[model samples]
Target: MKERIRWMALHGFISGVSKLGARRGDPQARLIADPWVRENPGAFADECRKRGSLIRCRAAFLTFDHGVAHEVLRSDDFSVLEQGSNLPRPLRWIAKKTDPGLLHPLRPPSLLSVEPPAHTRYRKLVSSVFTPRAVAALRERVEQTAASLLDDLDGHDAAVVDIVDKYCSRLPVTVIGDILGVPDEDRPRILHFGELGAPSLDIGVSWQQYQQVQAAIAGFNGWLAGHLRELRGAPGEDLMSQIIRASEEGPRLNEEELQALAGLVLAAGFETTVNLLGNGIRMLLDAPEHLETLAARPELWPNAVEEILRLESPVQMTARAAVKDVDVAGMRVQKGETVIIHLAGANRDPNVFPDPHRFDIERDNAGKHLSFSGGRHFCLGAALARAEGEVGLRTFFERFPHARLAGSGSRRDTRVLRGWSSLPITLDARDAAMSSSG
Candidate 1:
């Protein structure tokens, strides 16, 4: 009952407010509360942009304009809004009372929710392991993993396979598991936790889903505690072990902090990349012209990956709160106010890209898309995700040149993390198997 009440005070209450606002025709509310918006947000995003660069909704202000979104994301005047900060006093009290004490990825100490000084300390310790050189060194391993996953798909008697299950989801989790020193046997459980907890990043989840998310967090926290203890006793070459040692040498991370950081890494490391690969696979199959372009000019693979990010950002939107009164897009946003930065809309802003909806693998400025966000809070796994996207997609298509969508694929029932839950696909030219057998 306490957990139910707590869930109601936080996710439930906010979701109710947003749903009411959506019914009354608020663009930002519709964007958050409407499930259809998750699947087809372009229209709502356009409506928000049409209203103004910075506009108010019933609960908070929002922006889909690229420039405004960029400013809010990169500016020091704004910071990530702590969970329940925007809630009314009574609800906040209720939420505090029922706090689960689990190391939630959206709560403090996790890079996603914390502010500077602590965020700085935690990120500094964790960033060393994900440096460009470190990520680059893993590229060969990523390629090999991709090949192995494809080999598994090939060995299957049936030509049709769900890319999300068999390929897109497997590559990143396997690679990230290896990077984090998780035992091979434990990867599947982590993946399950990830799928359940993903909705925790979004607003307007059902009470049932919130319950499931909490349960997943509980499971992950328990598992991570044991894993971290093992690392502390005898560290390995993995990123988690390195982080453990680095913290001991400098500003030490407590058990809670270590869980927050490592949990975030383990979850964020693969979750977004899973979406990137799944989205990239669906997009490439839809646009064979670009695939042909990629095949002909293999060197464009990196930029092609960027284009995929721009066109279908894995993370659709994020929020930042004003630290002080600030002027944006010729309007004043007072302190304590929050603004949602619609990254998906910003990526499609016509001001930035010519015919933004059109997917062009050769887009020169595609890297400028705020898909990974910017400034002090830039995605810690950007390099790794890009490497995964480029390697995963390129290797899949290279292996099965005639791969095609077998049927209409189903998108995940998630608002924040956009990707397919099931992407049915047919691998290879139809007669290739017969010819090989002969």
Candidate 2:
């Protein structure tokens, strides 16, 4: 009880300081804590711009300027210390005193939190398996998976189907799971892991949410350990098997690193792809003409997918911490301070993209958007994500060209990710259309 109180007091003090600093009206002191940002991030980004390109939100700096955000992302002066590096001194101490065993188990950071030789090594290991060629080889499987998902929708008696649940949510998990050699019977459990594990990445997860994250990590680790043990002894034609063989052949990953890599692949693969599909469908349905254009010219589906990413990026924001004092966008960001990169805002920057608010599927430069991020931290799964998004969109439109919005959609309650929680859509059945024609 005493430990919990101390922890609460420490967090309360931090929040108090954040609110106090925000009220000063300093040009660099805009608060992103406004709950409204969750619902309308673009508006929040505009507010950040009004304050200055470089502004403070709690302990972090925010930049809506495209150039500044891009530069900070690529800059060696900034690092990803706060996100995935070692836990802070206070948190480490608290965990040590409160739950010693859970402390070490919870503290091992993923690639998102590492730096230097370690980051390079981890990236190389992952890239070896998650290659563009590998993703390309899986294209047929992705297409097949999309068809199966839509076919399930067709079997439903209800005309209005939630695309998020029926297609967007299922396809990516199934694809990633298949690639990882997850057993058919265990697929649902892994999918649940991705769902419950997502909140772990949120900046302001509640106590209950934090507990959920820990539970997910513990559960996943236990499952992965058993799976890896089996794969080590008898390798198969799967990504996990390949990783196990590589670990045995050369520079090896410790048990913790192995588990972390598996979990990363599962969670990251599931979350981003789910959002990409949801966002693309919402955008196309909003402008039915674009869907028609894609259906008519299948070749343009790739460009259409790119434009959707630019307009409604799946991952809205990322952050980097300064390793040393540096001037960015005319503000001196001190060492250990963080800069929040609003990828969605930067994608919409008018100077970088003319008439940015307008969604143009034919926008020639749509490929230049920072949706996949940039520099060293560029998403390793970029090629896979693109392939998934393109194929998923193309197949969906081709299968149900007359699909339309049946009801109001609801957005996910996520501050950093933009996607739909429930997107209700209705597809036209061929028999019904023929009956109506008669």
Candidate 3:
């Protein structure tokens, strides 16, 4: 009920503002101008397909067709926008005023927001560090972290606990924090900033939510600036120190760029992993058979993570503006036009995956989903995310095999990201040994 009311209020606010400036007779203007489109993207896509796969909405085109979505994502003629502000004009103006630092034009663009050359440079800088070997090196640490987290939760004798809050949220933050040399005490703050800024990833966000994003950006950058300063004087054995050393030794990033890169890396590293763990666990709890199967054959945890990513992707959609005129799915998309790829919908397209909606851990081609996206923008931390998901899932069920959903879960009301805000569950320590013995 609370989520519904909030959704309705937000929808009304955005619609009211958009209608005030939107041209009534303009079909193209109604594309993303319809605020409700964000809430029911699959339905909106179905409606758009009446015209064509690349039907224009307001000024941008939305692709729900799987093949077209894939083609658009992989095309080099498209580029990310300079600042894809999700807020309507008035709301964005207010946000800019509330925290000007967050919208600083000089602020370094993160990998998600940066176009090539710069994007290429950032990817090259971090790719080698996340190689298979490097990710494997962290496997034991991720397992230990996950076990320690579940241990903390299992220590509580309460009948119900918010698993999202207690376990899912902390594991990724701790793992990423440890990698980045962020102190134990500061991990919580990093998690808070990540949560606060996450909604900004959506194509549209409310004024209040935009304000929260701006504040989060400011707080995050401020913290990064201080941390970078400390790392400069006395180097450590962490990734940040390695980055600082690289910057000093070679063609380097300025201080602001260095901080921006670190913030981006840390945020990306933790954010998606958190959702993967949360969403994967929720799916298992919803399907008790799958939960039992996973418990009995823990080797399937990797496949389970991939399936969860396909069905309920952490990053739901990404947009790109056409750099040159090109024909997309039989429609000519002109330069400067934006193409929105609905990844979640594409993943469910039956044309690509046979019986796409079913949750099957043994699904043969599950990794084919565009959940991590494609082309030059493919997720750099894919290996790390997968490793974290595998370990997190295995440790969670092993510690509390009998855990069951205890209450209704509340999902985060963000369009770009999908995951629960709170998932209440009950578990008993006694069930662990009993289930293991059986």
Task: Give the best candidate by TM-score.
Answer: 1
Ranking of predictions according to TM-score: 1, 2, 3
Choose 1 or 2, whichever is better by lDDT.
1
Off by over 4 Å in 2: 1-32, 83-92, 95-108, 429-438
The RMSD (Cα, Å) of candidate 3 is 5.5
Per-residue lDDT of candidate 3, residues 178-293 (tens digit): 77888888888998998898875653366677568767878887888888888898878777787778767765778867777788778778778878888888888889899878
**Alpha-carbon RMSD, each predicted model:** 2.0, 3.3, 5.5
- Give the range of the ten consecutive residues with the poorest summed lDDT in model 1: 427-436
CA-lDDT, candidates in order: 0.87, 0.75, 0.74
Among these predictions, the greatest lDDT belongs to 1
User: What is the clash count of model 1?
Assistant: 0
Could you give candidate 1's per-residue lDDT for residues 22-78 as a string of tens digits? 899887778778877887876667766778888888768888899998888889999
lDDT score at residue 172, model 3, on the 0-100 scale? 85
How does each model score on TM-score?
A: 0.97, 0.89, 0.86
lDDT of 2 by residue, 1-438 (tens): 753443343343343454566577432233324455667666766666777677765456778788998899899998875332333577546645665232122134477777778778777887788777788877878989998988887788876789998899899988888777888788888877667676555543455655676677677777878887877878788887887777667668988787777777777788899999999998888898887777777888888888888878888878788899999987888987878788888988877889887889889899988988888878888888888999998888888888888788998766667788889987875555676689
TM-score-better candidate, 1 vs 2: 1
Any residue pairs clashing in model 1, and if so which? Answer: none
Better of 2 and 3 by lDDT: 2
Evaluated at residue 319, the lDDT of candidate 2 is 78
